[model samples]
Target: MRPLRIAVCVKPVPDPKESNRLQIDPATKTLVRKGIPLVINPLDRHALEAGIKLKEEAEGKVTVFSMAPPAAEQTLTETLAMGADEAVLLSDLRFAGGDTLATARVLAAGLKKMGEWDLIICGAESFDGGTAQVGPQLAVLLGIPWLTRVCQLKREDDNHLLVTVEDETEQRDLLAQLPLLITVDSAVNQPRRLSLLGILAARKRKVITFTADDLPVDLAGIGLNGSPTQTRDLFTHESTKKVELLTGSPQQVAIQLLDKLGLTEKGAGQ
Candidate 1:
């Protein structure tokens, strides 16, 4: 059989450690990522790992794709260090402030340009957006079938796969054909750490970048203008705590607490 062709989609999100510092742009209603460090969306690492393992087993190459700003080139380089044979960055000012659908449109154009693939892998959701919409949307744009929240996957052959998916209620096993897309849950596998050799090898490879002009995308269907969902309001949540101490006998304190809580009447007999 010919080598398996796999494509993995990844995203660069703000570091979880510094999430508290993240802010929303009032003007654009988008994330204010400037000056913040970027990291691979945690679950996406698992997706990359799955693709790499499949490549190692099937004797194929894995390509990583991302739709992010030029700064995300570092994040893509990290994926190369993690075992992806090549990386592509879809960066353009016109691609900014996009919702999941708009983002999927850009990715679809990029994937079409990259040629055919046997499988595409992606994380179930992005850490920042927590919206599990891109994978399925991209599949729709590419005219392929897609599965999400996959916890286990095994190759039945070059053209078929057995997959298990889980949600809060139950797990279901399903068989999928090739030329497929799957959004894997974090439980699928543990992501491997970066090795010195892999890092060294990655430095020798260059990440290919594509702008809006490079792909066959309609200008009216990308970026902020293309997004159908609009944020009505954006703000940070504030929490406050209060404590009080009562001085009295056990019975008096209990009565005071009940009255303060407005439960005295309901618990009068009990």
Candidate 2:
């Protein structure tokens, strides 16, 4: 039987402290990651871990892909060290400042070139934008069955797979087949820690690099110029309401909190 082919999508994000300083220029209407300490997007790390674990369980190959500036190669290299069989970096000046749609387009093009894949995994949301749009958007571009917030997965056969997902109010158990896309929430398994052997293997892995020119792209709809959405403004806010300390026992505090929320004793704690 052919080994299962899995592709995990990841992104580089600025460090929390550094990224918090990001500002959008009204004139340019573009986001800039320059001078930011970039690391793997938090949720993407969990997605990568899912792929790695799936590979271990089913004896398959796992490849990691990133869509970001050329500088993103550093994170890609780190993912290799984390046990991915290979890494692909899709970087280009043209891809800079791409919105979710354009970003997904370019990413789909790049992944398509890697050959047939049985499964594609991605983080449920990005720390920078927190849009949670890329994974589902990419699945649409690929024209495949997709399920998000997947917390567990088990391979049943070459053409079938089972997954458990936590939706808003209930668990959504799924029986999906190959050529499907799955977006993972942080509820998934904790990502593996970096190890010495894994780090050594990463140093030897060859990471494939691609640019906008290497992939089939619609020049007019990609990059900063093609993005339709724009951020209006961002500013820090301070709450004007003062905090009132409720000094009392647990039961008393609970009653006070419930009253504050407009719930009466009958409606609150029973």
The candidate that achieves the highest lDDT relative to the unseen native structure: 1
- Name the regions of candidate 1 deviating beyond 4 angstroms: 26-28, 239-270
Tens digit of per-residue lDDT, candidate 2, span 115-208: 7788999999888789989999999999998889898877777788788988789997788988999999888888989899999988789789
TM-score of each model, paired residue for residue: 0.88, 0.84
Worst 10 residues of 1 by lDDT: 233-242
Please name the candidate that would achieve the greatest TM-score relative to the true structure: 1
Predict model 1's lDDT versus the native: 0.92
Shift in Å, residue 171, candidate 2: 1.1
Q: lDDT tens digits, residues 1-270, model 1?
A: 457889999999999888988888887777787778999999899999999988887889899999999999999999999989999999999998888999999999998888888999999999998989999999999999999999998887879889999988999999999899999998899999999999999988879999999998998999989999866787776766678897699877988789898998775545
For model 2 the local lDDT of residue 151 reads 86
- TM-score, predicted candidate 2 vs. hidden true structure: 0.84
Per-candidate clashes come to: 0, 0
Residue pairs with colliding backbones in model 2 are none
